[model samples]
Target: MQRLLPQHVRAATFDRRRWRGLDPEQVYAYLDRLADELERLTRDLCTANTEGERIRQALRQWQSRHTDCRHTQVAPNSRWHR
Candidate 1:
Protein backbone atom coordinates (compact mmCIF):
# COMPACT_ATOMS: atom_id res chain seq x y z
CA MET A 1 0.00 0.00 0.00
CA GLN A 2 2.97 2.25 0.51
CA ARG A 3 3.64 2.46 -3.18
CA LEU A 4 0.00 2.70 -4.22
CA LEU A 5 -1.38 5.02 -1.57
CA PRO A 6 -1.22 8.68 -2.43
CA GLN A 7 -0.05 11.20 0.16
CA HIS A 8 -3.55 12.65 0.45
CA VAL A 9 -5.11 9.23 0.90
CA ARG A 10 -2.61 8.34 3.57
CA ALA A 11 -3.40 11.56 5.38
CA ALA A 12 -7.16 11.02 5.18
CA THR A 13 -7.73 7.33 5.90
CA PHE A 14 -8.66 6.08 9.39
CA ASP A 15 -8.80 2.58 10.79
CA ARG A 16 -11.96 1.12 12.27
CA ARG A 17 -11.67 -0.72 15.59
CA ARG A 18 -13.51 -2.03 18.67
CA TRP A 19 -13.57 -0.43 22.15
CA ARG A 20 -10.35 -2.18 23.28
CA GLY A 21 -8.47 -1.53 20.04
CA LEU A 22 -5.47 0.77 19.56
CA ASP A 23 -5.88 4.54 19.71
CA PRO A 24 -6.85 6.11 16.39
CA GLU A 25 -4.63 9.15 16.96
CA GLN A 26 -1.59 7.00 17.70
CA VAL A 27 -2.19 4.88 14.62
CA TYR A 28 -2.57 7.96 12.48
CA ALA A 29 0.62 9.48 13.90
CA TYR A 30 2.56 6.29 13.26
CA LEU A 31 1.20 6.02 9.72
CA ASP A 32 2.08 9.63 9.04
CA ARG A 33 5.65 9.06 10.20
CA LEU A 34 5.85 5.90 8.12
CA ALA A 35 4.50 7.69 5.07
CA ASP A 36 7.07 10.46 5.45
CA GLU A 37 9.90 7.95 5.66
CA LEU A 38 8.54 6.04 2.71
CA GLU A 39 8.48 9.16 0.58
CA ARG A 40 12.04 10.04 1.59
CA LEU A 41 13.33 6.52 0.89
CA THR A 42 11.59 6.42 -2.49
CA ARG A 43 13.26 9.64 -3.53
CA ASP A 44 16.63 8.38 -2.29
CA LEU A 45 16.26 5.13 -4.21
CA CYS A 46 15.44 7.00 -7.46
CA THR A 47 18.46 9.27 -7.01
CA ALA A 48 20.75 6.29 -6.39
CA ASN A 49 19.37 4.50 -9.46
CA THR A 50 19.95 7.57 -11.61
CA GLU A 51 23.53 7.92 -10.35
CA GLY A 52 24.22 4.23 -10.94
CA GLU A 53 23.01 4.50 -14.55
CA ARG A 54 25.21 7.57 -15.11
CA ILE A 55 28.26 5.74 -13.72
CA ARG A 56 27.54 2.74 -15.92
CA GLN A 57 27.30 4.96 -18.99
CA ALA A 58 30.58 6.67 -18.13
CA LEU A 59 32.33 3.29 -17.68
CA ARG A 60 31.01 2.12 -21.07
CA GLN A 61 32.26 5.29 -22.76
CA TRP A 62 35.68 4.97 -21.15
CA GLN A 63 35.95 1.31 -22.16
CA SER A 64 35.08 2.17 -25.78
CA ARG A 65 37.96 4.63 -26.06
CA HIS A 66 41.26 3.10 -27.35
CA THR A 67 43.74 5.93 -26.69
CA ASP A 68 46.65 5.58 -24.18
CA CYS A 69 46.15 1.86 -23.43
CA ARG A 70 49.58 1.64 -21.76
CA HIS A 71 48.76 4.17 -19.04
CA THR A 72 45.38 2.58 -18.39
CA GLN A 73 46.75 -0.99 -18.45
CA VAL A 74 50.07 -0.58 -16.60
CA ALA A 75 52.27 -3.65 -15.99
CA PRO A 76 52.17 -5.50 -12.66
CA ASN A 77 55.54 -3.96 -11.63
CA SER A 78 54.43 -0.38 -12.44
CA ARG A 79 54.34 2.29 -9.67
CA TRP A 80 50.49 2.16 -9.49
CA HIS A 81 50.41 -1.68 -9.40
CA ARG A 82 49.17 -3.32 -6.25
Candidate 2:
Protein backbone atom coordinates (compact mmCIF):
# COMPACT_ATOMS: atom_id res chain seq x y z
CA MET A 1 0.00 0.00 0.00
CA GLN A 2 1.18 3.53 -0.79
CA ARG A 3 1.75 5.84 2.16
CA LEU A 4 0.03 9.18 2.21
CA LEU A 5 2.05 12.32 2.89
CA PRO A 6 0.88 15.43 4.74
CA GLN A 7 0.41 17.29 1.48
CA HIS A 8 -1.63 14.46 0.07
CA VAL A 9 -3.81 14.43 3.16
CA ARG A 10 -4.41 18.15 2.89
CA ALA A 11 -5.17 17.98 -0.81
CA ALA A 12 -7.68 15.16 -0.60
CA THR A 13 -11.08 15.78 -2.13
CA PHE A 14 -14.20 13.70 -2.41
CA ASP A 15 -16.64 13.80 -5.30
CA ARG A 16 -19.73 15.78 -4.24
CA ARG A 17 -21.53 16.31 -7.54
CA ARG A 18 -23.15 12.90 -7.64
CA TRP A 19 -25.84 11.22 -5.56
CA ARG A 20 -23.45 8.44 -4.56
CA GLY A 21 -20.66 10.77 -3.46
CA LEU A 22 -18.90 10.26 -0.13
CA ASP A 23 -20.24 11.95 2.97
CA PRO A 24 -18.53 15.31 3.56
CA GLU A 25 -18.60 14.97 7.36
CA GLN A 26 -16.79 11.65 7.25
CA VAL A 27 -14.21 13.05 4.84
CA TYR A 28 -13.54 16.02 7.09
CA ALA A 29 -13.20 13.75 10.13
CA TYR A 30 -10.65 11.61 8.32
CA LEU A 31 -8.72 14.71 7.33
CA ASP A 32 -8.67 15.80 10.96
CA ARG A 33 -7.31 12.41 12.01
CA LEU A 34 -4.58 12.64 9.38
CA ALA A 35 -3.57 16.08 10.62
CA ASP A 36 -3.32 14.77 14.18
CA GLU A 37 -1.16 11.87 13.06
CA LEU A 38 1.13 14.20 11.12
CA GLU A 39 1.55 16.41 14.17
CA ARG A 40 2.43 13.43 16.39
CA LEU A 41 5.01 12.19 13.86
CA THR A 42 6.65 15.60 13.66
CA ARG A 43 7.00 15.75 17.44
CA ASP A 44 8.53 12.29 17.57
CA LEU A 45 11.05 13.23 14.85
CA CYS A 46 12.12 16.36 16.70
CA THR A 47 12.62 14.42 19.94
CA ALA A 48 14.74 11.81 18.17
CA ASN A 49 16.91 14.48 16.54
CA THR A 50 17.54 16.18 19.87
CA GLU A 51 18.57 12.90 21.51
CA GLY A 52 20.96 12.08 18.64
CA GLU A 53 22.70 15.46 18.95
CA ARG A 54 23.13 14.93 22.69
CA ILE A 55 24.81 11.54 22.15
CA ARG A 56 27.18 12.99 19.53
CA GLN A 57 28.25 15.78 21.88
CA ALA A 58 28.93 13.30 24.70
CA LEU A 59 31.06 11.14 22.38
CA ARG A 60 33.11 14.16 21.28
CA GLN A 61 33.80 15.17 24.87
CA TRP A 62 34.91 11.64 25.73
CA GLN A 63 37.25 11.50 22.74
CA SER A 64 38.80 14.84 23.70
CA ARG A 65 39.47 13.66 27.25
CA HIS A 66 40.94 10.36 26.02
CA THR A 67 43.28 12.22 23.66
CA ASP A 68 44.38 14.56 26.42
CA CYS A 69 45.20 11.64 28.76
CA ARG A 70 47.22 9.85 26.04
CA HIS A 71 49.32 12.93 25.29
CA THR A 72 49.98 13.94 28.95
CA GLN A 73 51.82 10.75 30.15
CA VAL A 74 50.29 11.35 33.63
CA ALA A 75 47.10 9.36 33.66
CA PRO A 76 45.66 8.83 37.19
CA ASN A 77 46.64 5.11 37.37
CA SER A 78 50.09 5.55 35.71
CA ARG A 79 51.00 1.85 35.16
CA TRP A 80 54.49 2.89 34.05
CA HIS A 81 55.04 4.64 37.41
CA ARG A 82 54.13 1.42 39.27
Candidate 3:
Protein backbone atom coordinates (compact mmCIF):
# COMPACT_ATOMS: atom_id res chain seq x y z
CA MET A 1 0.00 0.00 0.00
CA GLN A 2 1.13 3.52 -0.73
CA ARG A 3 1.66 5.86 2.18
CA LEU A 4 0.42 9.43 1.94
CA LEU A 5 2.03 12.48 3.58
CA PRO A 6 -0.02 14.66 5.93
CA GLN A 7 -1.41 17.55 3.86
CA HIS A 8 -0.05 20.37 6.01
CA VAL A 9 3.50 19.14 5.93
CA ARG A 10 3.28 18.50 2.23
CA ALA A 11 1.97 21.98 1.52
CA ALA A 12 4.49 23.72 3.76
CA THR A 13 7.38 21.89 2.27
CA PHE A 14 6.12 22.03 -1.30
CA ASP A 15 8.53 23.81 -3.65
CA ARG A 16 10.53 25.25 -0.78
CA ARG A 17 12.73 27.32 -3.08
CA ARG A 18 9.78 29.12 -4.63
CA TRP A 19 8.14 29.63 -1.25
CA ARG A 20 11.08 31.74 -0.10
CA GLY A 21 9.75 34.69 -2.17
CA LEU A 22 6.21 34.49 -0.72
CA ASP A 23 5.02 37.24 1.64
CA PRO A 24 4.24 36.49 5.29
CA GLU A 25 0.49 36.81 4.86
CA GLN A 26 0.45 34.42 1.95
CA VAL A 27 2.57 31.98 3.87
CA TYR A 28 0.22 32.17 6.83
CA ALA A 29 -2.82 31.62 4.65
CA TYR A 30 -1.19 28.66 2.96
CA LEU A 31 -0.35 27.20 6.32
CA ASP A 32 -3.93 27.63 7.50
CA ARG A 33 -5.30 25.88 4.46
CA LEU A 34 -2.72 23.16 4.86
CA ALA A 35 -3.71 22.66 8.47
CA ASP A 36 -7.38 22.19 7.60
CA GLU A 37 -6.59 19.83 4.78
CA LEU A 38 -4.27 17.84 7.01
CA GLU A 39 -6.91 17.50 9.71
CA ARG A 40 -9.49 16.22 7.23
CA LEU A 41 -7.03 13.80 5.65
CA THR A 42 -5.98 12.46 9.03
CA ARG A 43 -9.58 11.75 9.96
CA ASP A 44 -10.19 9.98 6.67
CA LEU A 45 -7.04 7.92 7.01
CA CYS A 46 -8.00 6.80 10.50
CA THR A 47 -11.43 5.74 9.33
CA ALA A 48 -9.99 3.78 6.41
CA ASN A 49 -7.48 2.04 8.66
CA THR A 50 -10.21 1.04 11.08
CA GLU A 51 -12.36 -0.33 8.26
CA GLY A 52 -9.42 -2.30 6.85
CA GLU A 53 -8.77 -3.86 10.21
CA ARG A 54 -12.37 -4.87 10.57
CA ILE A 55 -12.37 -6.48 7.13
CA ARG A 56 -9.17 -8.36 7.90
CA GLN A 57 -10.61 -9.65 11.17
CA ALA A 58 -13.80 -10.77 9.47
CA LEU A 59 -11.88 -12.63 6.75
CA ARG A 60 -9.78 -14.37 9.33
CA GLN A 61 -12.86 -15.49 11.22
CA TRP A 62 -14.54 -16.79 8.09
CA GLN A 63 -11.45 -18.69 6.98
CA SER A 64 -11.05 -20.32 10.36
CA ARG A 65 -14.68 -21.37 10.43
CA HIS A 66 -14.65 -22.94 6.99
CA THR A 67 -11.21 -24.56 6.89
CA ASP A 68 -11.12 -28.35 7.04
CA CYS A 69 -8.25 -30.18 8.77
CA ARG A 70 -9.50 -33.75 8.40
CA HIS A 71 -7.73 -34.33 5.09
CA THR A 72 -4.36 -33.91 6.81
CA GLN A 73 -4.86 -37.00 8.98
CA VAL A 74 -3.86 -40.54 7.95
CA ALA A 75 -6.53 -42.84 6.62
CA PRO A 76 -7.78 -45.72 8.82
CA ASN A 77 -5.89 -48.39 6.82
CA SER A 78 -2.68 -46.45 6.35
CA ARG A 79 0.46 -48.32 7.35
CA TRP A 80 1.80 -45.26 9.11
CA HIS A 81 -1.08 -45.44 11.60
CA ARG A 82 -0.14 -48.95 12.69
Candidate 4:
Protein backbone atom coordinates (compact mmCIF):
# COMPACT_ATOMS: atom_id res chain seq x y z
CA MET A 1 0.00 0.00 0.00
CA GLN A 2 3.00 2.23 -0.36
CA ARG A 3 2.55 5.26 -2.60
CA LEU A 4 5.16 5.75 -5.27
CA LEU A 5 5.76 8.37 -7.91
CA PRO A 6 4.57 7.38 -11.40
CA GLN A 7 7.05 5.65 -13.67
CA HIS A 8 7.28 8.65 -15.96
CA VAL A 9 8.60 10.86 -13.20
CA ARG A 10 12.34 10.47 -12.74
CA ALA A 11 13.73 10.32 -9.21
CA ALA A 12 16.47 12.91 -8.98
CA THR A 13 17.87 15.55 -6.66
CA PHE A 14 15.87 18.75 -7.11
CA ASP A 15 18.40 21.56 -7.18
CA ARG A 16 16.68 24.91 -7.27
CA ARG A 17 18.72 26.03 -10.29
CA ARG A 18 17.96 22.78 -12.18
CA TRP A 19 14.28 22.88 -11.27
CA ARG A 20 13.96 26.41 -12.53
CA GLY A 21 15.60 25.41 -15.79
CA LEU A 22 13.08 22.63 -16.59
CA ASP A 23 10.63 23.30 -19.47
CA PRO A 24 6.92 23.93 -18.78
CA GLU A 25 5.93 20.81 -20.72
CA GLN A 26 7.84 18.54 -18.33
CA VAL A 27 6.10 20.05 -15.32
CA TYR A 28 2.70 19.57 -16.91
CA ALA A 29 3.48 15.94 -17.73
CA TYR A 30 4.53 15.20 -14.17
CA LEU A 31 1.35 16.74 -12.79
CA ASP A 32 -0.79 14.70 -15.15
CA ARG A 33 0.92 11.47 -14.19
CA LEU A 34 0.47 12.18 -10.49
CA ALA A 35 -3.23 12.94 -11.03
CA ASP A 36 -3.75 9.62 -12.84
CA GLU A 37 -2.08 7.66 -10.05
CA LEU A 38 -4.17 9.43 -7.40
CA GLU A 39 -7.38 8.63 -9.25
CA ARG A 40 -6.46 4.95 -9.60
CA LEU A 41 -5.59 4.67 -5.89
CA THR A 42 -8.89 6.25 -4.89
CA ARG A 43 -10.83 3.79 -7.04
CA ASP A 44 -8.92 0.82 -5.60
CA LEU A 45 -9.62 1.89 -2.01
CA CYS A 46 -13.33 2.33 -2.67
CA THR A 47 -13.60 -1.14 -4.20
CA ALA A 48 -11.77 -2.70 -1.24
CA ASN A 49 -14.13 -1.05 1.26
CA THR A 50 -17.19 -2.25 -0.62
CA GLU A 51 -15.90 -5.82 -0.72
CA GLY A 52 -15.17 -5.75 3.00
CA GLU A 53 -18.70 -4.61 3.74
CA ARG A 54 -20.14 -7.45 1.65
CA ILE A 55 -18.04 -10.05 3.50
CA ARG A 56 -19.09 -8.67 6.89
CA GLN A 57 -22.74 -8.74 5.94
CA ALA A 58 -22.48 -12.33 4.69
CA LEU A 59 -20.82 -13.47 7.92
CA ARG A 60 -23.54 -11.83 10.00
CA GLN A 61 -26.30 -13.54 8.01
CA TRP A 62 -24.62 -16.92 8.32
CA GLN A 63 -24.22 -16.54 12.07
CA SER A 64 -27.89 -15.71 12.44
CA ARG A 65 -28.97 -18.71 10.35
CA HIS A 66 -26.78 -21.16 12.31
CA THR A 67 -27.66 -20.00 15.82
CA ASP A 68 -28.64 -22.62 18.44
CA CYS A 69 -32.07 -22.67 20.05
CA ARG A 70 -32.74 -23.51 23.68
CA HIS A 71 -34.66 -26.73 24.44
CA THR A 72 -36.72 -27.91 27.41
CA GLN A 73 -37.12 -31.50 28.62
CA VAL A 74 -40.22 -33.19 30.16
CA ALA A 75 -40.12 -36.11 32.61
CA PRO A 76 -42.08 -39.26 31.67
CA ASN A 77 -43.27 -39.85 35.32
CA SER A 78 -44.80 -36.37 35.56
CA ARG A 79 -46.84 -36.95 32.37
CA TRP A 80 -48.11 -40.36 33.61
CA HIS A 81 -49.22 -38.84 37.00
CA ARG A 82 -51.12 -36.08 35.17
Steric clashes per prediction = 0, 0, 0, 0
Q: Can you write out model 3's per-residue Cα lDDT over 1-82, one digit (the tens) per residue?
A: 6555565354554343664565756777777777778789889989999999999999999889867754578888999786
Which candidate tops TM-score? Answer: 1
Report the candidate with higher TM-score, 1 versus 2. 1
TM-score of each: 0.65, 0.64, 0.56, 0.56
Query: What lDDT would candidate 2 get against the real structure?
Result: 0.83
Per-residue lDDT of model 2, residues 20-56, tens digit only: 8678988888997997799789789889999999999
Q: Give all candidates' CA lDDT scores.
A: 0.77, 0.83, 0.74, 0.68
For this target, which candidate reaches the highest lDDT against the unseen true structure? Answer: 2
Error of 1 at 42 (Å): 0.5
Give per-model CA RMSD: 4.9, 4.6, 8.8, 10.0
C-alpha-based local distance difference test score of model 1: 0.77
For residues 1-82, write the lDDT of model 1, one tens digit per residue: 5454438647676657776777888888887887788788778988999999999999988977845674677679999888
Question: Model 4 segments beyond 4 Å from truth?
Answer: 1-21, 69-82
Across residues 1-82, which tens digit of lDDT does each residue of candidate 4 receive? 7565444344433444654576656766776777688678878988999999999999988878767522434566786445
What is the C-alpha RMSD, rounded to one decimal, of candidate 2? 4.6
- Pairs with backbone N, CA or C atoms under 3 Å apart (clashes), candidate 2: none
**Ten contiguous residues minimizing lDDT sum, candidate 1:** 1-10
